[model samples]
Target: MNGTDLLALLPEGWRRVPLKATCNFFVSNVDKHSFDDELPVRLCNYTDVYKNDRVSPDMELMAATATPQEIERFHLEVGDVVITKDSESWNDIAVPAYVEGTADDFVCGYHLAFIRPRKEVLDGRFLFRCLQSRPVALQLELEATGVTRYGLPKDSIGLAVLSLPPLPAQVRIANYLDGEIARIDGLIAEKERMLGLLEEKRAALISRVVTRGLDPNAPLKPSDQDWLGEVPAHWEVQPIKYLAVVGNGSTPSVENASYWSDDGYPWLNSSVVNEPLVIKASRFVTETALKECHLPKIQPPAVLVGITGQGRTRALSSLLGIEATINQHLAFIKPHCDALHPGYLCHWLGHAYAFLRSDSDGAGSTKGAITCEQLANMRIPVPPTGEQLEICAHIRKSLDVAEPLQSEIQNSLNLLMERRAALITAAVTGQIPLEELQP
Candidate 1:
């Protein structure tokens, strides 16, 4: 059904009101240049509205200076609602945050709009919840315009309508939501913490098994490498180059349509390195393009490492589950199977991510990358082939146990977010009365 049909379903004593009729809207005048860190005032930026339900003194707002005139024109007050006016996605546009507590020095920053509700017509908290509710949010998303960075134009937002209940009922609904959402958020946080612990445990298991071997009581010797510390006495410390044939791949020109095919050779990028085993690629290349692009076919069981990109991606390593070619940002290592197990090498590289990233040469470059020479020269702890297989098996078994628990927690978190959204929709739409929520 359309918005008009949804509005017709409002409860008794409720009426559809244009946002401009209920609130005074003001777009922020302060730009990046207006910010002065030395000033004592705080700026309520876009992130403050997008990520939070309320803007308060406790939030880490950016410090800036506004002239007395600017401050007088834009200073925030208690009960004011801040909304994101622009974002890269329409779903993020019109995100609202209620202003709470004494925020005398706070001014709206660029890309935000301040909404002050008329006391007799609207409650600030209620209005914030209404904007967040599914009906209004969907309307805002539909009205938002832009190709890359979506924006909720001031006029468009002002023209949007909300189904407003009497002030008392509005307050009650907002209060009920405040309590319920906080409880849901707490549960999500707990689940997220559990997931973090599980990840840490998984990483520790991989690091320990790969470096120290499965037999804890085995003899130890100094490896002389700072990252490896000590390995089993039987293990050898050798450069990766000596253990594998390291090479990179290429990308076919996208401008040439002939280079693309519906079903062709899988062309992997650095991103696929995040998966434990990359069995398929997001894109494919025609045989002609592969030959012209000089893309080498990476054999299965070979370790693929992301030598370029941002964050942990620069150090990510995974085993190729199929014969595929990679982009220049990825390096494939064909380990000498007779001496080193591919699984063992992949796990060791995964464990050494931090060390490898630190030793990489592109410290100051925008695209952080590890040179092929640097990767080949990097030292790794190598156990005997039999022992390497044992370690790999043990690591896999540990992950098999831990990963499911992590998945369960993640699923719970996703459900909590969905429940939160549904609760807001139900409350604001008058489908679930505040009285029904009361203990």
Candidate 2:
């Protein structure tokens, strides 16, 4: 918001403060040696910062290292802000969150920085919202400096400013957002629950129907594979190579930026097709670019994965959106024969995804991988073609019911977020008078 817009809403005596003056900027200086079996330091990284403005709810990971000077310098207090000091993309940068660590005196790493504010100047939550606003995010990007990739520089932070209203108005904005955002969160939480159940039901449908067929009375035999436990007597396990023609894709010339375009053929990345359903309109491709690249023509509705990337998303089982080429980081799969159900295979492959990651990342490699041989050798528990169709039908129907219910929940969550934003807009702009919330 501009100075005039803030003035239109604020009471007399209110002043806009340069962010540096409004908050105490503490530089992060994490040493790479303070890690050990320790009683003291609580490690924090960018991954710990969630969109929810919360620290990582789970404690599975820890910090790299810390120094005594670094530790004390990085101490966090309630109402203080923590944010990613730098990011590859401004959009990827997390919104500021008040200190949310579980530790009594938590320490932040180099990847993040802290902003300790004078309690009288601004409401911590409202300032956090200010940071989350699109205008602010764009500002961060436009002003940020780096060689090739833009990054927020510590020196540039103080120079950035806000159209802050009076302290009382700031509290009102924070209170409004807090009171209303909770309702939105409830909606989001419900949507998440629906999504979880849909996924579970989908998996159960796949595992059950694929292994046992539609007829329960169908005699079953033991599948000796320990991971698979058992399956129907009629069914057999086969390698992926027998079912589909698989290959890797390439980036024609990322070095030649002109090869990439917003308008043209849909160049499919594994990410574009990461849904159960076949997606259309991939990230974008060109005929020239396609001819130049060795990307195989992927048929619609093939299962896919990222052969690389450190995130769980890379390990996900996704269906293709279009007939397009894939990158090296992706491995594609398609089923063969009429009896082999594509949907059934998709559901099954999705089930095996995590197991595959664990298997590779465990002993085979410190880093996760799905080698060409490993992919070919990968086992598929196959039933008769008719039975495979039946399983696919069952899964599609269950997900058909579940997906829309989840969509509605997601829509509700969206509204809640909109409402939260609206509330902030209103209070900060004084569209809703502050007296409404005051005792």
Candidate 3:
């Protein structure tokens, strides 16, 4: 199971086949309906299935008026696979799921499609898993035809092929996966908990650094800033303009549109900075566009922040190291790294983010922005240089511990997801024996 590709792991005498060949198409269209009582059948949707391969009956929305008799022809036999034909994004468009119990007989909207396998040819759960693999997503993407965005069209899936395993082996593979995935899932959950705890600890460490400095025994006094409340007696409150410079961004003409090609100068938007450290941006701008707009290239890792748009979004600031341009929705802040201690400023800015953002003097508009004057008045408590370094050092150590925990959490979850995928692949392809399955 650990050493082979899904195809290599299959049992003897199994054959790979396209979905079009072995299963009867189980579909129903929208027809006039009625609804007073709750439908007995459990309805399902693409959302009902998770990327983790977990099924949620809660996503089920019922139409009591749906025709039970009409639905019967489309009835899901235990082991039938259900799929979603369309989704908001290509990544979400197709989700294949295994059906069990009365949910098999439930009515679905126009977006869902079901497949009931012919007994001698394929396993229901196995086929569903194959439809979810990276290979399947690639196939689905190739078939999409939308002008604005891609999707998983039913036409492509109608002709899709998959490996079919013998029944007993299919059962064994599914059972093995059920147990294996459960253990992986447990570990992933634990890692996630550790990550949450790590984040909390980091946040607390920063708060302590910015407020108390490195000396827990340092003399303390009340802070004049309303939100800050108190700080170390030696700490001094100073305006941001004294410590940093802020700049805005611009967009060039879109009518001529020559600057819209993929290979262009990188452009960073506020949304791009909405994540911590703002590592990447979604779009690129042409050199011509940047020149036309007369926008200067922003120094990376300079603590770019969003000041004018997207209400109450976090990560308004990011620490970047590359050169890029930003949109009007953001403000690029260049810290006096030599004297101010850049890491300390980034951490302190993060702490005062909510209060500083609220203090901005924009119009009564939903998106609040501050003028240069308002920014110049934005006060932050400045601990002595030595203490600032101490605080920054503590922060670095805390992040060192936190970041790896977060990575482990994601890795564990990824392993569970992959194992789940492999299980589905093996079951459908008859890599395991069903009679050997205990449940």
Candidate 4:
């Protein structure tokens, strides 16, 4: 059903009220450029509302300066709700956070709106919950508009409608949601921890089998490579360049529309490295673009590594299940099958991911880059062709079992998040009776 139809379902004693009728909406007067860290005031930024339910003085807020007039106008008080005024996605617009308590100098920052609800008519916490409910969120999403960044105009927000139950019922529903959501969040956190442990176990298994070989009784010798303390005596150590052809791809000029195609050669970027075996690209480029850009088509069964990007993407490694061209931010390595198994090389690179990223050199900022030269010189423990295949088989078999367990845990986490959202929506809309939850 449509949002208007959903709003019509408000129960008895619950009236649909324009938000402005019961709340005072104010936009921040201070711009980001005006912020001064030396000043003692705390600024409640967009993330404060988008990521949290309540703002507190103890939280790490951005420090800034505000003029006396601005502070007087935008200062946060208990029972005030802060909301995101703009975001990259429509679903994130108008997300709200209730102000429980804040430092004496706390003021709302730009790209946000401060909402002060009339205490006798509305509960700020309940209003915050209501704004996040499915019906209201759907309405907000439908109303938000922008070419690049979605936004909710102050007037539009003021005109938005919400189902307002009696103040006592509002309080009861909010209290009931607080306990139930907290319980669901706890389960999500535990599942997340389990996923982390599973990933760690998988990494350790890959590292051990790839470097040491599957045989526990294999004799060891000093490899003399700093990263490789020792390896099986029969194994050989070689720079990755000796065993593979390593290179990066290029992007054609985006200004030239002729360079792109609806269906052409698959063009890959560093982000595709996140997939276990990349077989498709988000966008394709024309043959003209490929030739003009000098993009190299990496053959299938090659290992792909992200050479640029923040966080873990720089260290991400994957195997290519199809022939594709990559952007400059990715390095493709085609291993010589006679010397090294592609799967074995991919797993070894995965094992050395952290070290490879840490040891890389670039113009500046080690956080998100690795040069082609640095990647070529990276060392690997190489076994005989037969041994390499054996090791790859062992690692793949272990992952065959562990991967499904990880997927199961991840599915559980996803369900918990959906359950949390559904529960909040149900409670705030009065679908769940408050009387059933009270002690």
Candidate 2 TM-score, C-alpha based: 0.79
lDDT by residue for model 1 (290-385), tens: 888898887787999988743457878998999888888889899865687899989888888888777774435533688788778887888888
- lDDT digits (tens) for residues 12-100 of candidate 4: 68888889999999978666445454345788888777778889777898877877778788889998988888875577788888898
Off by over 4 Å in 4: 1-4, 12-170, 225-227, 249-259, 269-271, 357-363, 433-439
lDDT of 1 at 230: 90
TM-scores of the candidates in the order shown: 0.66, 0.79, 0.59, 0.71
Which 10-residue window in model 3 sums to the lowest lDDT?
30-39
| Pairs in steric clash, model 4 | none
RMSD of each: 6.0, 4.3, 8.3, 5.4
Candidate 2 ranges beyond 4 A from true positions: 1-18, 24-40, 56-63, 68-75, 84-92, 101-105, 110-113, 118-120, 137-161, 250-255, 285-294, 307-312, 335-341, 360-373
* Candidate 4, poorest ten consecutive residues by summed lDDT: 31-40
Give the whole-model CA lDDT for all candidates, comma-separated: 0.82, 0.66, 0.65, 0.82
Q: What is the lDDT of residue 110 in candidate 3?
A: 55
TM-score for candidate 1, please give it. Answer: 0.66
lDDT for position 429 in model 1: 77
Candidate 2 total steric clashes: 6
- lDDT (0-100) at residue 432 of candidate 4? 74
